[model samples]
Target: MTTAFDPVRIGALELANRIAMAPMTRSRAHGPGATATELMATYYEQRAGAGLIITEGAQPSVVGQGYPDTPGLHTAEQVEAWRATTDRVHAAGGAIFAQLLHTGRIGDAALLPGELIPVAPSAIPAAGQVYTHEGPKPYPTPRALTEAEIAETVDDFARAARNAVEAGFDGVELHGANGYLIQQFLSSNANRRTDGWGGTVEGRIRFAAEVTAAVAGAVGGDKVGLRISPGNTLHDIAEDDVEQTYKALVADIAGLDLAYLHIMESAGMRDLTASLRARFTGPLILNPNTLPEPTGPDALSLIEDGTADLVSYGALFLANPDLPARLAAGGPFNAPDRGTMFGGDQHGYTDYPTLT
Candidate 1:
């Protein structure tokens, strides 16, 4: 039986182990232009022991931003800023993938330039609050994106993927999960359009398929990946037909021959994941733990049972830098500070002590 510490091949990239650092939103990009800073590079460099590192969600465009202080890939300066971070990860013998996120309707105008209203698949307002410089505010009803604008959004993702490659990243992962722009289109409640982009399952999955194909076309298919949550209700997203919807989605993108399909598992969604695994023919990275539960022996079991090719850990990897060695030795592991999990200085970001 293969262990999680063993080497695994994901598309054209060869990973040293089966462990992956899942992307978590750390609002520490306080650079001049919302670009990645030296501190961010240090944070990632410290945690470069993982087989793969999926950086925090980066907005493909200015309006794609949903949170405060998150990074973007829409500008040349941003790409230049990210290059240093990627170089550090590469020097440390780690492969990194940039995650492209468009927050869609799950945003506030206060976070946008000139108080620009956020855009989504439809004019629906997610029933929650979004973080802003002032504080948390109720999510506003986002403007419906026109068909032309939707096409432009697809191009934005493609351009961002190319920019990631230019920034020295190994690949790009499209954030199609967590009620963001792509998931908003996947959810019938959020996307009520009657045009070619909505109504049927094929229509709803069109955006994600197009975005994946565009990114694969921009970069190589082996350098592009996608993440999805089948029954996730985060950020007020409701998928009435989770089974059929995600099945259609997996089938639609199965032929892309992309790098991997990352699935953030919801509670009691193992059968759905298995079904998706059958539909997809590439590498599968499974994030089994949601909140509160720490990833440990259970994640390894997913790999041992062949349910996942790679297992992703978020909070555990955030807290422990040398997670692969710690797990192999079965010894001490550092606890992550909840308060410093978001915006903070080097204290919780890069100050985690490694096993000496």
Candidate 2:
């Protein structure tokens, strides 16, 4: 019987176990705008027990950032900042990848400083508020990206991918989930363009696929991966037909020959893997939200039965640095302090106790 501790090879990276540390944004970067801090590096080095560590969603450009202190990868200074962290993780004998994300319409006017109007697939403003430095700001009406601008954004993602490799990351994961730029393009409610990017599902997914191919070309196909959420609407995204839209999109992504496919597993009400598996023949990384119970044996069993190639844990790994060992020994895991989940000092970030 294969246990969670079993070593697994995912893409260009290999691990001692199938357990993975999901990319989680702590919003702890001191100087914002894509700059990584020493605290951030220390934070990652402490949690290297997992088979793999996918760093938090890093904004590809200035406008791609959403939160107050989230890191970016569009600058030389930012790249140098991240190199420090990656060097530490490598020295610890751990491998980590950067997850590239574009917040799209999730941006607040105040958060982005000069760029008040965020660019999205369409002009529709999501029905929600955004967390900003001062407070929550109502979702702003985003500008519809011009055909030229959309292509440039895709290039921004490609450039960010190239920067990640230069910064010493093992690979880059394209974030096509959480109602961001890619998801905004994927959502019919958000995308109303008649141009090459909007009408048909293929047209909408073209941005994501093209960006993936470009990044793969820049960083090698073996060093690229993508994460997707077919039915997620975290930022007021609306998908009319989840089945058809996702199936069509995945069918295109499946042939890309990238590293792995990360699925932010939602509810059992929707059988996610059933259709997507047919499209993507690579390793499947699963991230099940613990809406009720936190991560437990049942989640691991999915990996055991080969339903997923890897299991990604978010809060669990945040609270327990030695998460793999804790699970193996049936540990009393540390409960992550919700108040400190996003910001503050290193107290909650790296001070979480491992199993004694």
Per candidate, the number of residue pairs that clash is 0, 2
TM-score of model 2 vs. true structure: 0.96
Misplaced by over 4 Å in model 1 are 290-292
Number of the top lDDT candidate = 1
Per-residue alpha-carbon lDDT of candidate 2 for residues 1-356, written as tens digits (9 for 90 to 100): 77678877777677888888998889887864558999899999987777889999999988888887899999999999999889999998888999999999888766666645688988899998987767788889998888898878888998999999999999999999989999999888899988889888777787877888888878887788899887787889887777777787777766667888888866762366756865787888888774444576767887888778888898888989988888887777788888888878888898987766
TM-score of each: 0.98, 0.96
TM-score winner: 1
Worst 10 residues of 1 by lDDT: 289-298
lDDT (10s digit) by residue, model 1, range 167-201:
99999999999999999999989999999898888
lDDT of each candidate versus the true structure: 0.91, 0.84
Off by over 4 Å in 2: 113-116
